[model samples]
Target: MNPALPLARLGRATLDALAAIGQVTLFALSALSHLVRPPFYLREFGQQVMQVGWFSLPVVGMTALFTGGALALQIYAGGARFNAEAVVPQIVAIGMARELGPVMAGLMVAARVASSIAAELGTMKVTEQIDALTTLSTHPVKYLAVPRLLAATLAMPVLVAVADAIGIMGGWLVGTTRLGFNSAAYLKNTTDFLQAWDIGSGLVKGAVFGFIVALMGCWFGMNSARGAQGVGRATKGAVVAASVLILAANYVLTELFFSA
Candidate 1:
């Protein structure tokens, strides 16, 4: 057993991870630099907005709604042991506004939008369309990546806001119907306990998550290998990377926003 082998493997993995991080950072910077350049693709931007935002609403809404309802039930059950069941509405609202709403929406968008972007761009790369665009004097990053990055970043906050509302409504519904709570009182408690900062923080998290999702997709897609298997791998990598980054970013943002 060569003791140096394990250390060597660890060092190699660390270097590989660092290199990947550097590459992604450079890719993101390149795409962002193209945002202010001329020949803006309004049509592409509009299509991406619709694709990433509007089409994502239903999934975001449903996820939030179910999560809120389940959260209320769990809180109520837990609070029962302490005779604090009356705190269900408040807790549900705070949880959804501060964490679940934005995180859930981000993961959902990462799964849907990130994979789609990666697959589409990977296909374009495989088919040489990206090269064709470059030959025609078009900057592929500007035409292909910038619109998606911009759209996702702008749309995520809106989706988080909508998710928060639906989630709170879900808690309200569950509280009033199943928990035998008064509707007016539940609504009042939810609104009274949820501060503007809570909602605002979640929206900000949403925006960051959205940017991360798009960035991962574009990076993987553009760097994908030259084959169908490579495109599939890129799509999978985009979703996985976006999801992990979303979770990691959520923790960082939560710490920054809520740490004393």
Candidate 2:
């Protein structure tokens, strides 16, 4: 193996990554611009809000509840080792409000909504429906991408707020029923420990993650290759990209919000 060959391959990969970023950034900007200049599709936007928000509630709630419970148990177990088991309520509230609730909700939405949007749009692309829209004088990005993107961005914060409440309640339930803590005291500790900024930061993270999810789906689908296998790949790529970006963005936002 030639040393120069590996360097060439690394350079190619770096260029490819940069090209992808540029393409995605342009796509997002186009969709955003369309949002303000529209024969506004109120019906499409409403449908997407339901699809991305209301239908996503059950999965987000379930994930938050179970995660909150497990977190409480783990915190209690670890804290017990230090004779600090009483910290369970406070820790769970902070963890769920500041981190787990938003991250888990974002991931769940990425898995469900991103994949669905990619598949739907990919199928439309493969079937020439997008071309039909163009011929009929409708901008596909405005009709399809804007609704989904705007809906997700607006809806995710609401979902995250619900997740945070359910998550805190889950901790309370576990602490009271399984961990031998007084319910009222657990609630008080949680409320006392969780700051308004923590929850607000998580909601902001949720909105960003939602935008990323829809952007990945729309970008991959619109650029999908022309075949069934291509659509499949686009769907997979959308979910993977959305999920990774959510995690990465989560860290960046956390650093900005909480760093000393």
Candidate 3:
């Protein structure tokens, strides 16, 4: 049990963590810089838009719908303790629009799209495809990372908007049928209490989360170790990192948007 050995291991871990962070930051900046330059790949971008955005609708919608319904039940139960059950509609709308909708949609996309991107790119890397692209004078970041990044960033807000609607609808269904509330009144309260900013803030969060998801996926994939195990690990790491970052970023964004 030598103190020097323990200290040495801790120092190495800290250095490794810092190094990883620096690498990811540089990678993100490089991708963003390339985004504004020439040779825009419309075909690749369109394919990514379909893959990262359109294909993600089902999972996002389902997640939001279930979350909204569960949230309504939970809020209703808690409000009942204080005879504040009528606050359900307002709470549900705000919660969904300002937080749950975007967060859930982001996490789902991370789970689905992030892993797919990581696996695709990781396989490409291990098979020397990325190197081949470089040999052909193709920039990997510009060709691979930029399109997915742009597609996710652009499409996430739309997905969150749709999720917000579906989520609110889920709350309405629960409030009306399960909670003994009137359908018209539930919808009215939801609309009346929700403001434009609530929706806007959530959409902004969607964009940020989308960027994080794609960036993490691409970063991990591009840096993945050789072999099947490495690709698997990269895919797993992308999902976990994206999900954690989404939650952390959500808290920060919430404070920025709503804190007094």
Candidate 4:
């Protein structure tokens, strides 16, 4: 009955989505452009480094530890059916490095940092502090997004490294204790299976995911609507979008790196 109207609305929705993506991309480029300019904000960069990297350590460590432990148990149990129990160490190492480590760390940072970015910038926007910066001839992109983006991009690789190490340790503990694996043998199996490429790919994933997460946060934050409700919306939207993007990106990266 309303075929024409529905088709028109569908076209508008597609256009709106495209526009949103374009806005976010433009905003990210603007921030990167500022990063190359003069009068660098070393203090802000240092502060964001602490916030994104140092402050994130505890959560990333614990997540990696528990995930690795669980992976060991699951692999051992699955392998018992075929008398392939010794595969636990290798599987755990590969899984954590190639898949879980970067994805989990990215999602966690998205939850933590994305929300904070949205709230902080949204508040500034609501209170006109952003406008004040504009009036003062200062670029907010430089002042806000550059530091956060650089911090996330640099910090995520470090965080993933810590996660990978701790995750392997967790698996080692579980393999030795619950799975009745000899510690030296377990370590050997892990080392024998994991190549440089596996770990390197994970670190690369970390950097890319970090950029996406921080970019989404800054984009949503800068474009967030006025007032508390708008800020809340931005926060929720950023986290949801970042998490989804991380998983989608992980799959793509995996295919690029490993698929024949």
Candidate 5:
């Protein structure tokens, strides 16, 4: 390999990445600023709540249910090695509420809502609809991005709460039916072990993850290249970026909330 060529390529890649980061940061700040100074679009916000939140419930619920069930089985099997199988309820409750529930809901919403937003906006951009909005004196970021961002952030905590309940119920179903535990006992153990912080922390994580998801979608879509292929790429990139960011943010939030 030629040393000069490789060095040039590395430098180019670094610059491109930095440029992308700068662009995204500016876009995020713009959206945030639009969020407070309104011309508040309550109708758009309500539509997004339905699109992003209400439509997302089934997938989130199914994911939480299966994950909770599988987690129960895994934890039970693992705990049996140390004669601590009885810890299942408490562990499941904490595990789901503190981590899995928010994470799963966030990822699921990213997959669904992020892709939809990216595809829609990317299509609008390529079709010159965004320009039309601008020509009509509508700020694209305020008209398109801010409402979605606010809706997602507000709705995600509710989604996470539902996910938490469904997940714990899943573990309860497994514990009572498969693991030969009493229903009342399992419920009691779950409630007894859970504190306000565990659930609250997850909800907080949900809000952050939701913001990341919508932000990534809007940012990528706004910057998408022209044509169908560009729109497809933008949609895919939005989901991938949102998911990675969600997981990364989750770890950071977890450390802040739990690492005493």
Candidate 6:
């Protein structure tokens, strides 16, 4: 008897998804256009840079450190079976610099910053504060989205850089104390094996991931539906979308950088 209800719900869900996608596209174009124009919001950008990059340092650092420490232990353990334990330093450096460092940092920032941005903008939309900004002749895209995109894109590499350093330190601690690695010898092995390009490529990947995170957050928020339900939906959607995109982009970048 209620078969029609489920069909109607399916139709409504399809429409909502289409509407959200359209809104996200328009927001991206508007933000892109505004990015090139004047009336730059350095103040806003600085705040976002601090929020997305600086404020995220502790989480990012801790993530990297734990990952590096675990990686060192695992690598050493695995290598020991084959009498290949000497590969630990090289593997650690390569693994962190190539993949884990940027990807983990990106995910952390996406979780922390993306959801917050979506909630903030969704709140503004619901309260008509966005309209107020428009009434005051302020382009919300320029003032909000562009700054966030720039901040995340520019700051992610720096975060990854710090993460890389901290990660290496964690490996150093594990290698020297637990793994019976000579401190000086481990240091020399790591430094000698790592190339500058390995680190640089990871930072580049981080920047791209950062852009995706901010873009998804701003897109979802700017296009958020009305009411409390809409805000909650948008916030959750933004985080999920950003996380997926980060992992997807990481894979693409890895292929591009490493494939012959």
- Please count the clashing residue pairs in each candidate, in the order shown: 0, 0, 0, 0, 0, 0
Candidate 6's residue-wise lDDT over 175-197, tens digit each?
99999999889889999999999
Over the stretch 78-150, how does candidate 1's per-residue lDDT look in tens digits?
9999999999999999999989999999999999999999999999999999999999999999999999999
- Candidate 2, residues 147-219: lDDT per residue as tens digits? 9999999999999999999998898889999999998899888888888998999999999999999999898
Find the number of clashing residue pairs for candidate 4.
0
Cα RMSD (Å) per model?
Answer: 1.1, 1.0, 0.8, 1.2, 0.8, 2.4
Tens digits of per-residue lDDT, candidate 4, 96-151, equal 99888898889888888888887888888888888899999888898888989998
Per-model TM-score versus the true fold: 0.97, 0.98, 0.99, 0.96, 0.98, 0.92
Candidate 3 local lDDT, 1-260, one digit each (tens): 88799899999999998999999999999999999998899999999999999999999999999999999999999999999999999999999999999999999999999999999999999999999999999999999999999999999999999999999989988999999999998988998999999999999999999999999999999999999999999999999999999999999999999999
Q: How close is candidate 6 to the true structure, as a TM-score?
A: 0.92
lDDT comparison, 4 vs 6, better candidate: 6
lDDT of every model, 2 decimals: 0.95, 0.94, 0.96, 0.90, 0.94, 0.92
Superior by lDDT: candidate 1 or candidate 2: 1
Q: Name the candidate, 1 or 6, with the larger lDDT value.
A: 1
Clashes of 2: 0
Q: Write the per-residue lDDT of candidate 5 for residues 1-260, one digit (tens) a residue.
A: 88799899999999999998999999999999999996999999999999989999999999999989988998999999999999999999999999999999999999999999999999999999999999999999999999999999999999999999999999999999999999999999899889999999999999999999999999889888999999999999999999999999999999998998
Q: Considering summed lDDT, which 10 consecutive residues are worst modelled in model 4?
A: 117-126
State residue 113's C-alpha deviation in candidate 2, in Å.
0.3
Model 5 poorest 10 in a row by lDDT: 216-225
For model 4, the stretches where C-alpha displacement exceeds 4 angstroms are none
Model 5 / residue 75 / CA error / Å: 0.7
**Per-residue lDDT for 74 in model 4?**
93
- Candidate 5 vs. truth: CA RMSD? 0.8
**lDDT assessment of candidate 4:** 0.90
